[model samples]
Target: MSATPSWQAADGCVHTGPLLQSVNGFDVVACEACGFSHTLPLPTPQELEHIYSHEYYTQEKPLYIERYLEDKAWWDEVYAERYERLEAELPAGRRRLLDIGSGPGLFLAAGRERGWNVMGVEPSERASSYSREVLKLDVRSMFLNEETAPTLGQFDVVNLGEVLEHLPDPAGMLRLVHGLLAPGGMLVALVPNDFNPFQRVLNESMGVAPWWVAPPHHLNYFDTDTLPRLVQRCGFEVRHVETTFPIDLFLLMGHNYIGNDTLGRQAHAMRKTLEMNLRAGGETGRALKSRLHRAFAGLGLGREVLAFARKIDDSPSPA
Candidate 1:
């Protein structure tokens, strides 16, 4: 586990708090300097490469692809909302997008179907292969690093969904994305909102173990505040922030899904049902849900956070 007295985060913030919790034998600590939390002894580059390229889909989560296929309709709805939001900010005829860690290339496909120029970079061999062979999407089977970033060219929007938490140096990744973005381009980063009030309530008040803290897979933890701060520090102007449905509310309401697969499925089903029903109600229903979720985001209560930022234009001022 390599437990240490203090650890320096990628953003130059040092974390010195005592161990917050240990999950799967890895120690986690909170960074008072940056209001972030992460695991100790981050994995090496080689280890990360092997894990993602080989073991991630095959060994770590064998049924991920199947489950994703099952929820394809719902996934499309989620992607549509994001695309609509980002497109609203863009001028007419500018819809180039690059999705990092684009698992199975579904997001890219959705964007392309919406008449947007889309590309993806995914490290997982199985997932990337599926994206290419099955989905016929333009997904590169490699990680997004300095060497590869330049070749990808500029993008109007960069999407990083559930990606930063898995990295050892998230700031470095964002910096690369900054360079890849066209002037005034947007960056959409979606990550799980951890260590929030709801999660603390579930862990402390309820008998739920810290189920969200999955080490080796998720090395960094971020809430809405910390995530925006990180993105802004990387030379982006934070535009909008919102959260998805707080699934933990089910647990809070006596539907204990912790450690029970059946209850967990039921809870997820109910949540999806509510969202699907609201979405079926057309524009009014969509607006209502958006307002409700925005309120939840303001309170920092959600299962996941979606932040939209724009690359700060650095053009020289005319004399």
Candidate 2:
């Protein structure tokens, strides 16, 4: 692992304030010059690999994928809408895409299905193999660093889906992504909106970590406000912004087990959680909840958000 960055907070992430007791384990500090409310005590490269290989992500096949693939027509319509929006502003045809941390190669699958030439960079051997063998796509098993980046030409579109916050240094990673873009290339990034309402309520009540809080996996958090700054720091200019993925199952999972006994026990926990969630709110309730969620999301409460930016000109900076 690289030496612990000089910018890391000496006292670590936890600190004291009047309103908030302890802000979990994150090391938050305002930059002396820019006053960015960002996390410090960022993970080292070694820490990053440990967190990613931990039990949290070892399990494959999240329930959402199963549901998404089973309902092909529905997912098609949804992706079409998304594809139109996410790709509309950028130039079409002759577009080569690179998806970092392409687990299970879902986006690559979509790209291939759409006839887009896509390449993936993943560190996990198992996931990379699955992406290649199962999805029949090309994938490279390597971390994104100076040594690992391919000398291949710049890409036209880069996708960083649920990937930036997982890095030890988001600023550095964004700079690297910027270097790999062709002229006028656009970057499509999606991270969990750290300031979402459900997250606020969860942290206020239960001290339990949100699923997105998997230690070491998520070392940084970004919202709409801070995200653009980070992007500009890495040398890309913000072109478009959209908060998406309003139908989040993670919050539903939490609302299911909240205030609930027999949650951590064996025997029917998953089944019971599903039953309780479906019962407290059947699909009808979930549908209405999604509608309400969209309304709140328009007000900035979406669980996930997708931001688009372009490399206006070359202006890469140092760490």
Candidate 3:
């Protein structure tokens, strides 16, 4: 196969740069300026469009939707936490929420139940239809960009759940999200925590390849430090950075589930079981899990990083 073309880094530097390694047919390189690793020769718009719309939930996982719905109880706990945080931080009376890249409208459903006026922009026909028809959510079946931002108008909160890493130009996408927000509006983004210390330990110490690094489908890699920096540069002030469960902990505990399909499925089921047990224990278990999540986030060991930021008001300060 032919080599892919190089692209400029977030710092605007254009050089061949240093190759970190290769994974799944893509060259992974470390950005000299920002110190974050990204996949080279970012996938084209058409390629990404087809992947997300047609193959993401089907070809990629095959059982993703089924698994997601099966784990709704555990996922709902996560959604509730997110809603509570946003509700507390955001100014009252500004409940307009726009969930960019909302898949199946789970979060939007959570927001609506919280009394927020919620809408979503999803690219997948299957997901969008499910969101609208099944959940009765107000979701536009399209991607969110400069041209589409105007029609959506301003929102008090804009969410990008598990969406940033898929983009070739994540910085550009954040700038668009900045435009979608009202003054003092919040931005919540969740991306895979690739290149983190825990992941490095998995690769270097445990003799496992970097299985977390997927390309084309996931073009950008961000960890705790780099994710917030990228958001700040895009005109949002960072508010909170937290993490979900570090499933890699299973590997550390002698369960090598990465490549083994049966083991991997068991690991997922174990996660759901643990969460369900904790949730059933009521407030005490919930509090303990919250603390554990915060601790994992502090160590930068979670599988995904959740960032909350607010759009900066650039209007001149009162003279």
Candidate with the greatest lDDT versus the true structure: 1
Candidate 2 global CA lDDT score = 0.61
Considering lDDT, which of the candidate structures 2 and 3 is the better prediction for this target? 3
Candidate that scores best on TM-score? 1
TM accuracy, model 1: 0.93
Better of 1 and 3 by TM-score: 1
Q: Candidate 1 clashing pairs?
A: none
Model 2: how far residue 184 lies from native, Å: 0.2
Cα lDDT listed for each candidate: 0.86, 0.61, 0.82
**Candidate 3 pairs with clashing backbones:** none
Q: Write the per-residue lDDT of candidate 3 for residues 28-61, one digit (tens) a residue.
A: 7776544466877666777888898888876787
Worst lDDT 10-window in candidate 3? 1-10
Residue ranges of candidate 2 with Cα displaced over 4 Å: 1-40, 53-56, 59-79, 205-212, 245-254, 257-298, 316-319
The TM-score of predicted model 2 comes to: 0.71
Q: Supply candidate 3's per-residue lDDT for 122.
A: 94
In model 3, the runs with Cα more than 4 Å from the true position are 1-16, 33-35, 276-284, 315-319
**Candidate 2 lDDT trough over 10 residues, lowest sum:** 13-22
